[model samples]
Target: MAYRKFRGTKLFTGKSWAPEDSVLITLPGGQVEAIVPASEAGEDIQAIEGILSPGFINAHCHLELSHMKSQIPPHTGMVPFLLRVMTNRQAAIETIQESIYLADQQMQKEGIVAVADICNTLHSLETKKSSPLQYHSFVEVSGFIGNTAQNRFDQGRAAWEKFREFGPASIVPHAPYSVSPELFRLINEFDPGCLLSMHNQESKAENDFFLTGQSALRDLYTAIGVNIGFFQPPQTTSLQAVLPYMNPANKLILVHNVLTSMDDLVCLEKHPVADTYFCVCPGANQYINQSMPPRFLLDDQVEKIVIGTDSLASNYQLSITEELKLLADFYPEIPMSHLLQWATMNGAMALNMDKKLGSFEKGKTPGVIALNNWQVTRLL
Candidate 1:
């Protein structure tokens, strides 16, 4: 392969940073030939930058809801916001498409390369077919608990088969809080050989219902005609509740872990067999609960945490860079490099694309992101 060099004042070479560096990245058949100091590369530099790093990867997003940017009210509780979302669902589709287009442009400008996007059906298929970014489309299914679980599972299976022809990465699931244990078991049987993504403990009400069989969610369930008596409150934590149905061989990417407690983290540590990951959507958390995930629970599990911009409907925008800035503000002690990995490499791993798209390692096709005039250094 012919080699190209990138000279930069600072280069983030996947795991670490090098000041005044040059990356000899081979092209055609993409691979890293060598990563040497800037003074070492002879003369074939293709680009020069003040700061360079691997392209960002968004772990969770609802691109179809991109059109709801600023349309949803700020700081609304999850239940009320979801009700509003359902009511305005039809009007949001066209705008969502437009949002996807604009979001693509914005992501590229801000240096994103791949995304784990959640889609309800065919809404994002067309947009994804044309976008330059890489995406893992999680076909979203939702229905009130009951016989509806099987029906939704069937619908999910049908959608998965239909869209399977569209791309290499596609999966299906019932949205959390909406999926029954039986349906979740059905999903676990698939063995997709990739990380499972789901909206885990995004709201306190969800945790409350699952833990104690009582919360605001009960009201919502009753209103929707879901038989409360037949529903046995989950005997375990939300993480444990979903564990039986998750593919044991594959990693699980838990999105919006807003209510995860210390005990939950301890359980995760004990069950080391489950390659669990956390994708924190701070903006979306702030929107729904006026709070963010408990960073303190992360502990020594920094490598297992990733970043995601949930959806424009519940976020300011689909920008991972902005998420990093927020992380910096909220948890300043967490190294910036680690934060970048959460937005980039860790996210890629969540979608099972790490081998080809996470870092600037040998054989990865992920692009490089240039950050100009940003002085934050040493991200590990």
Candidate 2:
């Protein structure tokens, strides 16, 4: 039987670093066969110039918005960025399809083995079906008005069901500001065990709106011709306002905690939801707001912190290595091995794909990737 053996500058098993003398052995198709000392490995061992680790798991991405790349200007703040996305999302069907295809191909080449992708429409369904990367579709629902709650829930549920037929999919709220109390309640009750991903505290405007009911978010609603007069300020942070409606049985993934504060973290600790993952897309945050999530988000307070590329609309590219490199540059204090764990294992666990992806454990077929001086390439 032919097996592939690899030794790199360093070997990260997705969880931790392998021994210096370890040589990774894998079946021809990339399944983990063993991690043996160099003395025991045969003469066919391959050498790598940089770190070898399992393929990355992108815990949060907006694949449906891939067509909106570069259409929205940078450093425009969240409200303006969102307004532009709403205004320009519509395009020729071929254009949308082509962008999704290209984005999918880009992820595969960058060593993203699986993704927890946001889907507002079926535009990406065919591409995901044929792509080598694994995808868990998150059908995002949003309705700020109480009256439209049921309709929005129904529409999102219908889309989720179609995606479920194709692969793993879930119905999730788009964001705290965009989801009404009624809509949140409906989504929580839909599936107790479902994985819930929400756009949480990406901007100060979100908490400002929830606390005072008067913010740029209201202006955004007005621009779209939606009446938000019936809405009232909850006199609390957005996360606190929405936590009660979240089912404890669900594994919640909070994406883009750019403005998540200490108070919010305390509130989260008191909440019943035990499994919470904080997914940070620094590239998108920097592009839209010229800011990054507080360094504390990577501290001990956040037990699980995963990385994502967001989408072409807010990010320059879909590479997790770029995201990691950006993170390394921003927070030079954090170790690369620690960041790799977040990019791979934490992300895979957040998406509930850890058993099959993330680490280089025997019997797991986590695709092999080589990070040569921050340049990413798939080796298997």
Candidate 3:
């Protein structure tokens, strides 16, 4: 049951493209055997029209909130958004299940092969078990200030351990904003081998609260019965502040660094041991704050960046294509090929699944998607 041959006008071989080319893929399990000039295939070549590339990997998403598309009140700050989320928990959970079902279908149809999704609970366990796509679920935990830092770490570790029974891809985290410095220190001390994911400087208010200890967030914390009077003003950039508490050997996918300044990027560059990756959620940023992360921060660091749709609760749709399209529209000077890699290869790397899922390489089984009016003859 070998595929024998597939000739497309455009063939993306993960890292580069083959123009007017053909790939002789050995199937039974789809793996690229050889990518050669179209004329080299003789008469056995099967010409495939349109584009062909590796399946996409959405590096960061909250599938549990998939059901809340356009329903959560917009333009609210993060605190208000959280309150709204709490209020709508019951309805949101029901919608989350439905959204996950439809979103999974949409991912397949759009040629996505893997995801790095945030899980607040076990709600997504059954869905992941049933889906063909690869998943790395980060069990998210957050606490402002209460018990001992060791207690907080224990709570997070306990929750993660419970979910670990379901699969191989479970990880733990102290949610940003709410995670105490002491708890973060414990996380660093434990030094888990898995990658770290956190919402970093997603809002100006976050920066204000963390850096200066003054902002609208202070009011929100007070309202929520979490006093901020005893808290010390943050001494370092968010990335630096968290570095001591994270496994330096492990890569980090910093989500929504909308307000991350040049100093932060410099600090990241200084940490040679840190594999720092950025996950931009354009739609989610716009929904919550009427803005998106500054694309310029990614400049020469495009290779270190990936894309995510966030979730329907904070986005219009769960489509990586749309995310890339928005990126292209905003940063038209950037090459389309590079943008494609951000949505695919970079994403796979962020999820630590590049070895098996991201690219259309020798042994990878990433699905091929054809764009409308895409030229297959160009490949041949």
**lDDT of the candidates, in the order given:** 0.72, 0.90, 0.71
**Lowest summed lDDT over 10 consecutive residues: which window, candidate 2?**
294-303
Regions of model 3 farther than 4 Å from truth: 24-28, 43-46, 92-95, 146-152, 271-273, 373-380
Error of 2 at 64 (Å): 1.4
**Winning model by TM-score:** 2
Per-residue lDDT of model 1, residues 275-316, tens digit only: 878889888888778888787755556788888888888988
Model 1 scores worst on lDDT over the 10 consecutive residues at 371-380
In the range 1-380, model 3's lDDT, one tens digit per residue, is 54657765576665667666666464546655666676666566666666677677888888877776677877887778877776665565666677788887777776677888887766777688788878787777666784666765676677677656755444445345677766666665665556778888888777777677676777777777777688776666555666555666766788888888888877776664368788888878878888777867768578888888887778877777777777777777877677678877888888878777667777776656554342112111
Q: What is the lDDT of residue 125 in candidate 2?
A: 91
Q: List the residue pairs that clash in candidate 3.
A: 9-376, 9-378, 9-379, 20-379, 21-379
Give the clashing residue pairs of candidate 2, or none. none
TM-score of each: 0.89, 0.98, 0.89
Clashing pairs in 1: 337-379
Better of 1 and 2 by lDDT: 2
